[model samples]
Target: MEDIPQKHEVINWKLEQLLVFLQYCNYKESMKGPLFYAKILLFGEYGIIKDSKGLAIPFNSYKGALKSVKTLTGEAKKSNSSLIGLYDYLAKLDTELVDFDLKSFKSDIDNGMYFDSSIPQGYGVGSSGALVASIYDKYAINKITVLENLTRDKLLKLKEIFSIMESYFHGKSSGLDPLNSYLSLPILINSKENIEATGIPSQKEGKGAVFLLDSEQIGETEPMVSIFMNKMKNEGFRKMLSEEFSIHTDACIEDFLQGNMKSLFGNVKKLSKVVLKNFKPMIPSAFHKVWENGIQTNDYYLKLCGSGGGGYILGFTEDFEKAKNSLKDYKLELVYRF
Candidate 1:
């Protein structure tokens, strides 16, 4: 007797059929896999790129899941069409190191199968990362299992693969976002290339609250990063980033890890000021006054929750009611109450 093919296997079979059609017409692969929603580093943006300690978590507000459908609707079809070009490129690349059931993968993609996710693009969340992780999980042969022991070496290997996978969206990727998605854990670290999962300080009563303030605009990360890179070329900017930004960022990370609430907020105050002075362009024009107001009044502190420009602005408030009152005109999404 033979075992029945599982639902996923059935879907894979359908995908293979579609791939044949696409290959016949010379269409390329597009999506790596379905991805879930990811939250941005409300405080760490350019700071993280410089190896300043950063923190990010999964945002459940929006999520995406992969499933093969007989038909796609609206944006789904359009997204799938765009992916064809990407898949074509991947097919031509040296994918010997990565594991992918390319034959079936191509078929599903060709048959109009697309990743159906609600995670918004260009908000600095790991939208592409989640998709990359999903693809690796579904198709990679001898893949790393989330259930198995994840040693540092395995984690590093996973990051390398994900970085390659996610490069399709961003011209370059650090692999941190997808790595976080793959592990679904709060990742803490000393540097980009050096990272690990660690425990976070729990919120305490009467402590500050970490929240998200929606900028109501979409932020394109590639451009923002480009700007930051150009700025890095300046000797003065580099000095300020290393001397001021890195100092504050490192202090905040250490204090948070040590569970020193007072020290964390103090360092966060400095971090907030530094971001306001250096990252003026990333903040939406409408929020400029508020950004300054928070720094001056200390009613609330604003940080780059993700890549800045738009989406959600990470806010830290000692008093939620006070912070709300201060920014009564804008919308606020509570993330964590510390």
Candidate 2:
């Protein structure tokens, strides 16, 4: 026989092994969880608010997922702390349209659960939208699964639910961001009430491209939106948005969807011009000349990727090489090619 305390020592070792196994399980589950990707609103930035067409596509460059941790630290700790606020907000939500498993959500949060994400916040790339998608995916009871046939009614229902949920982050939300991230598909907004899944032309080997120009700064949606609301009070600005802005935006969407690069460039240039002339406050002052130069020269056309106080500026060009050469000083990320 062994020492008198050998039995207790064996029990301790077994308990340690069990703890490791549980941790391994948690890690496995986290790894297997679905990743909600960031979304890019290619068209209909401010115009969508006033019932204009919009097109959004899932951008896999940045993504987020629900994860469990043995000990939350660093970004994970910060994320966990922030989730408490969301949990409180969700727990008190009075919506009869959907219900979340608050008990399980709270228990997970208490056990050091956090969203593992690389999507930058306040960048207009749907950072909070992805987080909201992750939570709804995991904790919502009778949640709408992506596998089902997403009829127009179902799509609207999901958007409604997401709008209410995401409103906690932004003062007001259209719900398009979270819906795009959640569905992982290109979404076309015909208007505020009519939205449907859409398919864009497959990427091709060509010179023309769509890219993101990094402003190297974060953008807050609330303030930018407030600025837009204040501008809407002016009759002239409202007419410009409805007549010039919306017209160009709708044409761009149509051209893009139809793969008519020739028409797309023409309309995108017009849209870029309108944005520069009117939405001056939305554009970062540093890039004011950069925006104008793109319009002056046919090298490229730049527009807002989101609300655009300071985030990524979307660019379109017939020849990316030329646009790259012209904007050589700035960091450019290619999003699409045609």
Best-fitting candidate, scored by TM-score: 2
Candidate 1 Cα misplacement greater than 4 A, ranges: 1-35, 204-207
Tell me how far the alpha carbon of residue 104 in candidate 1 is from the true structure, in angstroms, after superposition: 1.6
Report residue 51 deviation for candidate 1 (angstroms).
2.8
Off by over 4 Å in 2: 1-32
In lDDT terms, which candidate is top?
A: 2
* Residue 301, model 1, lDDT: 85
Error of 2 at 266 (Å): 0.6
Q: In every candidate, how many clashes are there? A: 15, 0
Which lDDT values do the candidates have, in the order given? Answer: 0.76, 0.93
* Model 2, residue 122: C-alpha shift (Å): 1.6
TM-score of 2: 0.91
Clashes in predicted model 2: 0
Instruction: Give per-residue CA lDDT, model 2, range 1-338, as digits (tens).
Output: 77576788989999999999999997787773689999999999988889999999999999998888899999999999989999999988898999999999999999988889989887788999999999889999999999999999999999999999999989799999999999999999998789999999999989999999999988999999999999999999999998999999999999999999999999999999999999999999999999999999999999998999988999999999999999999999999999
At residue 312, give the lDDT of candidate 2: 91
